[model samples]
Target: MKNIIENLKEYALETIEAEAEAVSQLPGIVDDGFGEAVALMARCKGRIVVSGVGKSAVIAQKMVATLNSTGTCALFMHSADAVHGDLGMIGPGDIVLFISKSGNTEEVKRLLPFVKKMGNPVVSIVSNRDSFLGTHSDRLIYVPMEREACPNNLAPTTSTTLHLVVCDAIAMALSRFKNFTAEDFGRFHPGGSLGKRLYMRVEDVFDKTNQPRVSEDETIKNVLITISSHRLGATVVLGPDGDLRGIITNGDVRRMVENGKDINTLQAKDIMSRSPKTVDKSALAVDALRMMEANNITSVVVLDGGKYAGLIHIHDIMREGIQ
Candidate 1:
């Protein structure tokens, strides 16, 4: 058992070293050909139809997803399925991109003739530029590799990594060329935590109906009742004509009690904090969270056009997974 465990570590290290070495050679392959391929896709008026077989087919789907998410339109067509009937998804202006380790897969070879018959421009990522798929392509992005990470040089390990990296490079290049911004990314991914951080405003997350406030001359007993009833841990003190005055929190009440102050003799104005942290209702929720974290407070006053609208608690931001 010890012998097997020791050999496992050695084999794993060898695999990693071999794959890293192959990846190190990828930069040299990104020459004029790579740029041309990216430019061709950028100029394409329609979606990028990426097709492959076996492990390459899985990588092709991932490429399609990345391209679509990064502002480039793309579709995945399995080479085996394309020949069977999926070729109908290809449009006239669409560009056909083929991924292959050998560039000579029988399924892709069979599918290529039909793609050519449709008069679509063909782009290929392949290790062997002389193979059928590479030789026949209109644009070629060559990815040369020493060997697979597989001990027998059969599994699609290092080669697939090279293919995926090349696809990502192409997607990122196109994204930059199109000037795709974080706002655009947020639009594409609206349901995730990342999207919420980028676009969710304080108005969207804070409770609107829970605007707990009290008059400055109100008794301290009522201020405690307001804070307790609203369950916000704090209350805003407003003056006549609804102008902002001050704020009182549970901590203030605790301190007053500890100091043995005459609770009955005081009003809201006497015990309230003169200044409190606040955020604009239109500001991003993530920004509000930052303010809360920086101030070491659990809530902040939400202002709408300089008027107190509501309170945004740290719990509210946390509930939305905006952190």
Candidate 2:
């Protein structure tokens, strides 16, 4: 058992070394042919159809998904499935990105003639630049061989990472070309945690119940009753015309008690935080959160176009999601 464990550790260490080398050589591999491929994909009139078999197929799917989520429309076309009416998914003006380590997977090889007849630009990622698939490819991103991490050097670990990073490079390049923003990504992935973090508006999460407010002339005793009854530990102070003026929090009560102020006589304006932190209710929840973080605040008053919108506590974001 110990011998097996030692062998596994040795193999893992070698894998890391190979992966480092691959990452280092990625830039050099991105020149020339990579430019041609990126140009073609950027100018593509239709979608990018990724095709591969076995382990390469997984990488193909990931590339398709990343590109799709980043405003570059893409779809995965299985090599085996392509022979059976699946080729119908590919049309003129679309770019086909074929992936393979050896660059000679039989399933993919079978579709070379059909791909040629369809007149779509074919881009390929291959370990060997001289393989049959690479030879016929219009553009190629060569995955440099650093020896597999496998004990026998037969598995597809290092090569796969090399391809994945290259695919990401292409996606990121296209992302810049298309000006894909966090908002665009959020639109594509609305149900995911990342979408929640980017798209949720503050108006969607704030609570309006018992939104205690007091007039500028209200005494400290009235303020205490308002804060205690609201249970939010805070109260909004309004001006003569009902405009927001200040906020009184539990912290203010503590300060008042420490200063030995006469609670029964002091007015709300004398002890409240003037020009209190506030956010537009229509603003994204994440933006509101950032404002809170930057100001060292735990809560903010929400305003909806000149009206008292609501009050948002930091904890409310966790319960209702950022959106």
Candidate 3:
């Protein structure tokens, strides 16, 4: 058992080192061809049709997703399927990007002729520049590798990593060329937590129906009731003319009791914290979270146009998966 564990660890370390070495060689591979491929894709009038066979096909799908998310229109078509009716998905204005390690896969070889006859620009990420796919491509992004990370050197291990990295590089280059901003990314990823953080404001998360408040002269029992009813752990204290005054929390009640003070004789203003943390209702929810974290508080008073609005709690922000 000990020998088996030791061998597994050694093999893992060797695989990591081999892949890292192969990836380090990529900087030298980024010549004028890579730049030309980026420019071609950036200027493409239609979607980028990324196609590959075997493990390269999987990387091609990931490339499509990255491109679409980063402001580029892209789609994936399996090289094997492209020989069938799937070839119709490629439009006249689209660019075809083929990924392969040996540059001579049977499916890629079969599909290359059809893609070339369609008059679409062909870009390839290949290791063997002399092979069929590499020689037929209009622009070749060569990824020269020594061997795979597999012990038998048969599996698509290091080569796929190189392919994925190159695809990511191309996507980022196109993204930068188009000046894609985070706001644009947020538009693309509106349903995820990332989009919520980028666009969700305090008004979106704060409860408008549960604005707990109490008069400054209200009894401690009524203040406690307001805080308990709202379930926000705190309540705002309003002045005589309904102006913002201070805040009272369950902790304040507990401290008042712990001090052996007569809680029944005290009013809301007597035990409330005069200086409370506050946030504008129009502010971002992430900013509210930052305020809560910095002050070590669980909630903050929400103000709308310099007037008392409501309370925003940490759990409210957390419930929406906004850090």
lDDT of 1 at 154: 93
Task: Report residue 306 deviation for candidate 1 (angstroms).
Answer: 1.3
Model 1 Cα lDDT, one tens digit per residue, 204-292: 99999999999988899999999999999999998887778888999999999999999999999999988988899999999999998
Per-residue lDDT over 254-322 for candidate 2, one digit per residue giving the tens place of the 0 to 100 score: 999899987877899999999888889888888788887888777788887877766787777867555
Q: Could you say which candidate leads in TM-score?
A: 3
What's the CA RMSD of model 1 in angstroms? 1.6
All candidates in order of lDDT, best leading: 3, 1, 2
- Assess the local accuracy of residue 63 in candidate 1 as a C-alpha lDDT between 0 and 100: 96
Model 3 lowest lDDT segment of ten: 29-38
lDDT agreement of model 3 with the native: 0.93
TM-score of each: 0.95, 0.89, 0.96
Query: Which residue pairs show collisions in model 1?
Result: none
Which tens-of-lDDT digit does each residue in 29-107 have in candidate 3? 8888788888999999999999999999999999999999999999999999888799999998999999999999999
**Ranking 1 against 3 by TM-score, winner:** 3
